[model samples]
Target: MSVRELVVLGSASAVPTRTRNHNGYLLRWDGRGLLFDPGEGTQRQMAHAGVSAHDVDWICVTHFHGDHCLGVPGVVQRIARDGVAHPVDAAFPASGTEYWRRLRHAAVFRDTDVIRERPITGAAARLDTGDAPFTLTARRLSHPVEAYGYRLEEPDGVTMLRGELAARGIQGPLVRRLQQEGRVVAPDGRTVTREECSVPRPGQKVAFVMDTGLCDAVHELAAEVDLLVIESTFLAEDSALASEYGHLTAAQAGRVAADCGVRRLVLTHISERYGAEDEPRFAEQAAAAYSGDIVLVQDLDRVDVPPRRRAR
Candidate 1:
């Protein structure tokens, strides 16, 4: 019954278009909800997307840019107003501590004091999400500001083969015991091992690379990921502008996905200049490089993280 999907709240880059709102993304992994780069109007967008403040367990800000962190105040206040009982961890660049303080305390409200601050100061860091099945890591990204990208990796596990279990005449309680104990004694006095019936399941990986140009960290983060959600702020024709503004073009995003062996490439943070009619052009440009699934994301789009790869 676990659900893992990325809910796109908003997709605009520097400015909000008539149709597109500012940046906001929610990654729902099992029971944890990670809110990334919440920009202006994130609260309203979350409501529109049927997400509540109580659903957010962590808030990850890429940088202090207005389009990335402006919604912190409203989100924080909303969490307080709703009395979110659990502690919400907020991660951002350590250099932007002052900006975070201003945003967290922009207005006076009944503070629940449930928001915990964990600033990222190093080139790489791991976030401690207690009991979460995945490892969360952050890496520095190539941006004009002190920005970071995040990667989540699930641990490799074993998948029980029902056919193999049936062939061994194992059923009901015996199957559960075998799975829990890794081995179980059958009625015939023969020991059935989990390895005999289960195959290796390679963990699924998801990376979020926002507000960054091409860099070594970008490739490192995207490498071998099942899903890569990255910014495509411009097309190939506007490569110069993208480079100057510390953003990635659709072609560049595609190349990164291909080079890094990403299974699926999700291109978001689209600029307002590209109208609705021009959306397909972005996907076309990206498709030219990456052979995998390419998705040009829009507001409120939900992309599921594909299941783990099973052993052949």
Candidate 2:
């Protein structure tokens, strides 16, 4: 049983309140675990979310703001403290090399885990992780400092066709041959092509856009994504303030998701001022603009990705 879900590690904007921590999100895709933002208190937040540093295979930072990257030290330290033998890749802005270096060694404990840093300096970069199931792509976003949004794409899967197999009376080796060679000669002198048996299906995509104002790049990054996790730091009423601070309000985030064909939209990095009373209403306001699924994230909430739509 493979699992794909987003574990809300922390969901607070700018400052940590008594009920919320700064920004942090853990995306669990099958065997891969990706940690994003990792603001202050992320280490403890992970524990509260029932995830361990051993489960993290990738670390992504959207920017260098304290509320976004301040937890890097603790997360790195915890990985070492747990003695995770596997190396974890860390991706962030190449321009923030100094900041990355500072936090990486902020208060080093015994270094047991290998933290490989792949800095992003251009519009896009592809990370080859040997034989991982998915590939990671980082793109530039509209932010004050150097910021990048990360996207994960899984390779396409093979579609089995029982109709073609039955029509050709093919089984065992001949079925395998048809799949590998795109055509197989049947005992009855009939030829079966792979196109007759298989259908093209695009790989699943997940995008993370944080700490950015509404921009074309944000829509570009999230277009056609199966799951889009973005920051909705304010409500619809504060759209102006959100724009002034380079943040997205609920309405803007919802409109972006609807326009981009996102299957599921997760709104996170909320301000502490929005309490329990405001959560449902915020989601409602966003829903009024977008027809797609909307999730108002809270600390330690687990959101499963909606099932993929199949060809009718």
Candidate 3:
């Protein structure tokens, strides 16, 4: 069976606390694992989360902040050290090429030559991961540095209705023929069409928004997503501080989720200032705006994506 979930490796914002590490998230979708904004100590966090370097198919960096990209060197070296057979794609701001290079080669190690570079330069761009069922798109975010957010969308498909097929006396080979050719002649010589039995299955969408203030791109990337993982760096009382540092407050994150029709809101990258006792306040603040599911992430937490929406 295929798995789709978000594994929180670390969820601290600017600094690491006793309970929270730096910003790191691993999204397991089907057979592909996409690691986002791996911060300091990400390798150790990955080990604790039971994720191996071989499982990573893509590394997406939101910006070159030390708290976000400091672990890139260790992760890259680990990939080479383990000699992962598959190619790992790395995506980040094209303007941060020098920073990416510095981290990628911070230490000398065996060159596995398996890492593929994919830099995002424009206001928006799309990447084609060969053989992957989904398309990845990046949009510029409102941050002090060149930052980008990513979204993944699976292609829409049709779901076969077994009951409809059985009622039409279409079975075995006839079912396969109907699916392949979109039509088949039933045992009664009646023409059966695939559309008559199957219903439209809408594609699933997941978005990752990190270290960005309120902006159009934020709303665009989050619109109508099945799962939205966003940074809620501060509470509503610290809105000034959050705006100054290009981060979103809990209320803002909630508003975005409500406005964008996000089915699930995952609040991560929390500041250490909010101690364990204050965690509930953040969820309460967000709940004031969004009625959907709210998840205040912690280190090593696993959140499964909601099931795909069925056609009515």
Give me the displacement of residue 104 in model 3, in angstroms: 0.5
C-alpha lDDT score of every prediction, in listed order:
0.92, 0.86, 0.94
Q: What are the runs in model 1 whose C-alpha is more than 4 Å off?
A: none
Cα distance off (Å), candidate 2, residue 41:
1.5
The alpha-carbon lDDT assigned to residue 73 of candidate 2 equals 95
- Report the backbone clash tally of model 1: 0
Best prediction by lDDT? 3
The number of the candidate with the highest TM-score is 3
Residue 121 in candidate 1 has what lDDT? 83
| Clash count per candidate | 0, 0, 0
lDDT of 2 at 14: 92
lDDT of 2 by residue, 211-260 (tens): 88877788888989999999888998888888888888888888988999
For the record, the alpha-carbon RMSD of candidate 2 to the native fold, in angstroms, is 1.8
**Best-first order by TM-score:** 3, 1, 2
Q: Candidate 1 vs candidate 3: which has greater lDDT?
A: 3
Candidate 3 — which residues are off by over 4 angstroms?
none
Q: Candidate 3's residue-wise lDDT over 93-188, tens digit each?
A: 999999999999998788778899999989999986899879999999999998999999998878889999999999999888887899999999
Candidate 2 segments exceeding 4 Å error: 173-177, 187-189
